[model samples]
Target: MTTIPSIIEELDQLRPVSDVAGKVLSLLDDSGCGMSDLADIIRHEPALTANLLKLANSAYFGLPGKIGDAKQAIVYLGMTQVVDLILLVSCADTFKGSHSGYGLDRGALWESAICAAILANALSEKKGFKSTGLTFTGALLRDIGKVVIDQHVKSAMPQIMERVETQHISFMAAERQVLGVDHAQVGAMVAKRWHFPPLLQCIIRYYHTPLQADGCFTEASIVHLADAICRKMKISPGVDDSSYEEDERIAHSLGLNETVINGVIGEFSEKMEHVRTLFLAG
Candidate 1:
């Protein structure tokens, strides 16, 4: 078996976000970027421009008449939401594919990821967590490590699963024991290679083990619950299945009791169903 350091060092296949999305991310991280500035940057990507225009006119936005202008679309959607879509579209090639090793078919990871992102955004807001956009992005890109380590994971599944059953450990823990690294840790390395913010790196690194996250424990916890909810609900089973246990204490810490959990499930479903069409059209 390869050491974790070697596995990380060998991760040269990590996909870089598109230049336009990279620029947009830089500006979003900046404190001074305005709507006009964001519009100016997105206009250079013709496909992104067209998609934004389409989404701006989608029924979900409910604007009067048509919005043919780039600035208008940016204004209507807000920078955070626009950035969210950009990240999705830019990384589509990377995340929208099937990873047989991880048990996700084509676009399964994409569906689960966006679903988790939407819920994480909502959860962060409800919990009064700072930087909801960061939370959303972290959730969206949390499992990217799976892409790098999927084949290794798949080959080791027999041992991984055996540990899960015999040691009373989560599937991810078994992954660590078998591979010396889990998807979450590999995901953090992926994020670092992609120039993701430190907080996002931390969230991805410890999403499956939020208690290990020192810098962004709450954010990691939010991502954890979101992933668990998706897996439990089978929103997009991927390869991980639904073997991991949900941390009720973590949910309680975020004020997600049974009622809130039920509400989150319902809201997550409704939101995905309602806005997915817009995303597809875009």
Candidate 2:
């Protein structure tokens, strides 16, 4: 088996997308970036522009007419949706691959990420949390570490599986025992390298266990819960036992009743095609 490089070394070798997301957010916040400005930013990338336009006109958006340009798309979709779309486009390639170590096949990771992101966004909306755009992006890419860590996990599969089978341990724990680091840590390191917002870095790192965070933002907790929910619902891409204890505190923090959570799952299931359409549309 090839030796997995030290976390710091591995991080140093990869490019971060957070800086790009930050710049995009800054431009959006500064307000000098109107539809024209948005169009200008996307124009240089024809593929992104075309895809954005496609999504803007998709059944998900329910627009009155086809969006002919990026400017029009942004105006109709609203800046928040536009930004979310851009972030989605930006992270597409990174999340598309299979992580066989985790049993994700081609497109499996992407589907899981999309489902988690949608649920995260839905939960955020339900809780009235602002920065829904950032929450959605963070949730979508939250598992990014899995991409990099899969190779190491593949190498250490035998030992890791042994632990999981015998110890009733989480896969992440097994991963740490065999590889010295887990996907969440590796993912957070990568997000930091990308210059992603500090909040996102935290979510990437701790979404699995958000109550442990000192500040314990409700948004992070929502994503954490949403990840577990997605896995439990079998929306996850790969084969996971999906057996993790719930953080009851998150439910309380968000004032989430079982009814509301159930409703969201029903809505999510109904709208999944819309979600898939946004990403998979030509």
Could you tell me every candidate's TM-score relative to the true structure?
Answer: 0.90, 0.88
Winner by lDDT? 1
- Candidate 1, 1-282: lDDT as tens digits: 656776776677566778887787777567887888888888788998887787778777688878897887766766777788778778778787788887787778888888888788777766777553477888888988888888788888889888988888877888889999888888888778877777789999988878778988888899988888888778768546656777778888777777777787887777666656755323
Candidate 2 residue 27 Cα shift, in angstroms, is 4.2
- What tens digits encode model 2's per-residue C-alpha lDDT throughout 117-201? 8888888888777553367877888888888777677778889888888988887887778888888888988877776667677
Q: What is the C-alpha local distance difference test score of candidate 2? A: 0.75
Which 10 successive residues of model 2 have the least lDDT summed? Answer: 236-245
lDDT of 2 at 15: 54
Misplaced by over 4 Å in model 2 are 1-4, 12-22, 25-39, 237-241
